[model samples]
Target: MGERRDTQLDALRAVAVSLVLYAHFLAPGGTSFLGHLGVRLFFVLSGFLITRLLLEARDAAAFEAGPALRSFYVRRAIRIFPPYFAVLGLVWFTDLEQSRSSLTWHALYLSNFWYALRNDWTPWVLCHLWSLSIEEQFYVAWPVIMLLAPRKRIEAITIGAIAFSLAYRFYWPITAVPALARDLLPPASMDALACGGLLAVRRARGADVPRWMRRGWPAFAAAFLAVVWS
Candidate 1:
């Protein structure tokens, strides 16, 4: 059976995209934070949807990891790669010099690393690919962790991931790591993904959010403040 549509999540996606569009196109200066929030929302949404699908698949398959893993990779590749390569092809045919020069990294799904290593966002045309690269990296590893881990351990694993991401984000800044790399590295950004995954796992287990979090606005406000603090 096909998954049910989620209108709330659809609204969130629309809002996130609008935030990014407005940040990049409509807003003047000092609005990069909006763009960051939009991208973080996208990361969370992707994590939630993908983990939910995997959990559903696992249950349907009676926890058969092989089939679930195969189905995920195949579907992910089909849905992600074609349009990605098509975009690259357009860039190539149009002779976009900067994007074309970096096309190899994007094609290999290493654009994030390439940008982080350089500590720059040159080839501005392809700068956005860094987030896509992080998503692809997460896609590669998350299914294995989600599908293969013991059912009871899923929450713990997700929590550990969130902790690890937070630790990395916190620890990197105090060290010599370049700012771009600190922010763009996969580990540093996994908290949002893991937070989303945690929500999916809890939902799949038929668990409701804690009572303290049940009121939506308060939780949202707290999260917004936490993001600002971090």
Candidate 2:
């Protein structure tokens, strides 16, 4: 089951990356809807995979908060920081004029917030790091919640997060909130991640796939069409 799921996820990742590359190279002005969809797909996929890993760790014997958190942080740092700093260093050395003042924000994983407030000042190459910052921020909060919350309440929490994210995005105009608050922040984007986490929880609990979704190619066709239309 795990192998099959991993294969499916790899396929999805390939599709998402392909869409992003296509948008960058083929689409006019690099503003294609496909590019946005690709990023959303990545966000959902990341949430699902990370939650599944944490769930597995929780199920293992001798799980403890301190050790689990330390391991998680160490693993994340090793996996993420090396390549990230390398790229940042290259950008800093080659494009000092554009990256000098804003390098601190990237280093501190607050590039998203910085860009939100000063959209016009963002260097194009580092603009993409905004999503990475959001993911890092989510990682900080999710493990603690998962460790402390009752298993029965996990789904409820995920659903509540999704609802809160939707409300934050939708209510911004009505409340006259600044665009910066709603656009690049983690809260406004939690819905997609929470949706993925919810699915992971349901699957882990052995919930059956819905009849409509289990109908095979027809269901797949409908989903594909919906995505294309969107």
Best by TM-score: 1
On residues 29-110, what C-alpha lDDT tens digit does candidate 1 reach at each position? 8657778888889988988998898888878846588877887888888879999999889988886755777888989999
Per-residue lDDT over 1-230 for candidate 2, one digit per residue giving the tens place of the 0 to 100 score: 01126889999999989988888788988366787678778888988887877777777788887777777778888889999999999988998557877889999898888877774435867887888899999989998887778989999999899889877777765764345556578886787788789888888889977676677868665654444333
In candidate 1, clashing pairs total: 0
Report backbone clashes per prediction: 0, 0
Those runs of model 1 whose alpha carbons end farther than 4 Å from true positions after fitting are 61-63, 212-230
Q: Where is model 2 more than 4 Å wrong at Cα?
A: 1-5, 175-181, 210-230
**Looking at model 2, which ten-residue stretch has the lowest summed lDDT?**
221-230
Scored by lDDT, model 2 comes in at: 0.78
Candidate closest to the true structure, highest lDDT = 1
Q: Please list all clashing residue pairs in model 2, or write none if there are none.
A: none
Report the C-alpha displacement of residue 157, candidate 2, in angstroms: 0.3
